[model samples]
Target: MQEPPLRELRCDVAVIGAGTAGMAAYRAAREAGARAVLIEAGPGGSTCARVGCMPSKLLITAAKAAHDARRAGEFGVATGPIRVDGVATLQRVRRERDRFVAGVLSEFEKFPNEDRVNGRARFVARDILVLEDRDTRIAFGAAVIAAGSSPAVPELLAGLGDRVLTTDTLFEIPDLPRSLAVIGGGPVGIEIAQAMARLGVAVTLLDGGHALAGLRDPDLVARANALFAAEMTLHFGTKVERAESAGDGIRLTWAGKDGAGGSGVFDRVLAAAGRPPSLRGLGLEEAGLSLDEKGGPCFDPRTLMGEGAPIFVAGDAAASRPVLHEAARQGRIAGRNAAALVRSGPTGIATPAPWVNLAMVFTDPGTAAVGETYDPERAAERVVGAVDFSRQGRARIMDRAAGALRIYADRAGCLTGAEMLCPEAEHLGHLLAMAIQDGQTAQDLRDRPFYHPTVEEGLVTALTRIIDGLDAR
Candidate 1:
């Protein structure tokens, strides 16, 4: 019997992936009067709602409540002993997670049915895509690649056969393990390790180097290490060479940079190494797009456009900024530019103004970095403003005094970047980002009102140090 012919469809723009960036790109293209079709493979909810941010935060919130209750004795307000129910805690996490995913699905419902394609897509030509499941061919004037990302497992941890988990699979477990070995020291690893540790799990965090959560300042890195070390086992400068299934647990053997080696066995192993762009089987090379060292599409960061093709890569697929807000911004930019490519043919459009850079790790005393974070290699070129939060009035009053803040300024006295490890650093990160975005000087921020008896007042102390440094120069 002869097979049926493939169905053919056409659109002004074809967006692959239905995550944050893909959704934003589709909306922008449609708003620009372009026919845009969104192609997604099975999973519909974005990574943030599904696994990355929301669920993790829900878990962390539960962990924080338990931690605070255990420490109620410091405030001399103790009702009774605190006990954590692991099963109940995770049940609530999954329950709240489903609610958040439902909201994202509602947004997916808003898109027109004709614009949605349910299948995996691969580029067969520069302007064409073939949906393998539907046996449909789509021709587009321009395309946006927003095909999200997945957790990557290192070769050393492969074939362990059981109990090896990544962020993608970690949250779905029925209950917390008695002990966990976190195999990466990046943001995800650090956050999960701390949260699990606080919830009565023995978490051991291992890293090949001393870097903690992308902190660039030596002082801050040391401070953060000291803080985290008090709670869990930290094995920096240690490289894991072997992992194997040992009865009901996994055995990990490692060698340290100091010529020391150690081995341990844990009930579970979490490979929080990193998340690479999920572009497998998309046939990027066939689309005439080049790959970088990390296997991401080679595209201009400013326009999100591939160097030699009429294709734009955004979100986690672009492998630029992996956060949700950055993904949304890239989606809008890529969508607008893709539509312009369709409407006005070839000559590029003006790029949107860049957004301020802000990132945070949701640890107890959170870590935040805004703009160009401090780098010791360029120490002489910038002035540093420092504050010890342990001495801040609000921190001492609240009995949560265990963090530091560092703000950076150029020689011209303009506020440039900041890195901090303090309670509510997320808010401080946003405030600093706005000042830097507005091109404000250290003196300008100093003139602004700083309310008394608040964590924000710590900013005044740091700014005064910057002014003093400027005067001395």
Candidate 2:
């Protein structure tokens, strides 16, 4: 069964990139009765291991400890002065991050196929990929673009070099900044802003909207904004007018909501803006793959298949949802479907069913939303269920409650979504998200047993309210 070395490296599937989605796709494709060639030009470890989820969470975990120690007094638990070792903390983050990455790399090395192609990949024909530098050609029956994305910095903010930081490079810095100004006050920005501020960095968050972390629910937005306003200097409805080097620091000028301008000289300016789909040098047109208005591969959302082509788009490369979990789902589904296509079959999925949208911002009083965000147009038809954590017994016991939760439901009583600015919202968010994903109704959610004296109790209270609203209608 051995083949000649000097021929087309053809396979049932060819997967691009080696990030979270790419790896998942590769594994799933293997299980789906296909051999795959995973192509990457750089280290093929999970992106989350290197620069994303895991590392950021590690940094936040350290910040949370330092933060919690400082606020221990509210619970009559007196603690000594807290001093965070920024150098040591960063060392731990990198060490753990590297360990996670190493594990992924090791797993990759053990992959049975060992059909990895190292070098730039470009489409020379509809189903033909050429490794330009290596002069290797691969004709895959089905190809997947799990190519990952990178943090997007505006062209206007380019050339700042070391003065500006992105999430991808933020953890690389050896030391924390004395002062920081965060651009694009979204989830990533707010998380880093608050975590650093808690770790003792003076922080200023300049966001596009009046809301903190883009809360669509007006009431939740106001509450979350008020919470963050007390900690960091906030300039909402503002845009960065100028960013320039000022001596050893960076000077930023922003135009505020009132048309008034504000300026600050900071030790660093971090951009947690957004991720652009990685499409550079891909030569997708050579594969007969067309691009959508979003500048991504035009693919069927359900099967991730390119329009009448053998290419399936997955993960950040497609820029759909842009969350790790969503990317994972895309990769698995796309991997299975791509293999099926290679077998001359359809995936049996026509229209893509939307997953429950779950977004979380890790801050002191975390911000989270699942599924539907509040829209004024549909506000009247939806039933609202709410609970203020500030009044919850468990929250009062912990002395850390300072936010609210609002759950929305359809007229048929199915739990649609929730927006919350609450303590331990990350946990609360997952629970609500799972409920929505499982198609649980208000009564069904209420039927779930609740233990006394816990955050789950708070959710129960909210569910009861929704049930009442359902009964009234």
C-alpha displacement of 385 in model 1, angstroms? 1.1
Give the local distance difference test score of model 1. Answer: 0.91
Task: TM-score for candidate 2, please give it.
Answer: 0.95
TM-score per candidate, in order?
0.98, 0.95
The reply for model 1, stretches above 4 Å from the true place, is none
1-473: candidate 1 lDDT, tens digit per residue: 98788989999999999999999999989998899999989687999999999999998999999898888888999859787898999899999999999999899888889999999999988999999774799999999999999999988777875599998888888899999999988889999999999999999999998988878778888989999999999999999989988889999999999999899999999999889899999988889888888666899898899977899999999887899999999999999899989998767554777787899999979999999888778789899899999888999888889889999999999999999999889888889999999999999998999899899998999999999999999
Give the Å error, residue 442, model 1: 1.1
Error (Å) of candidate 2 at residue 188 is 0.7
List residue ranges in candidate 2 displaced over 4 A.
Answer: 1-7, 347-352
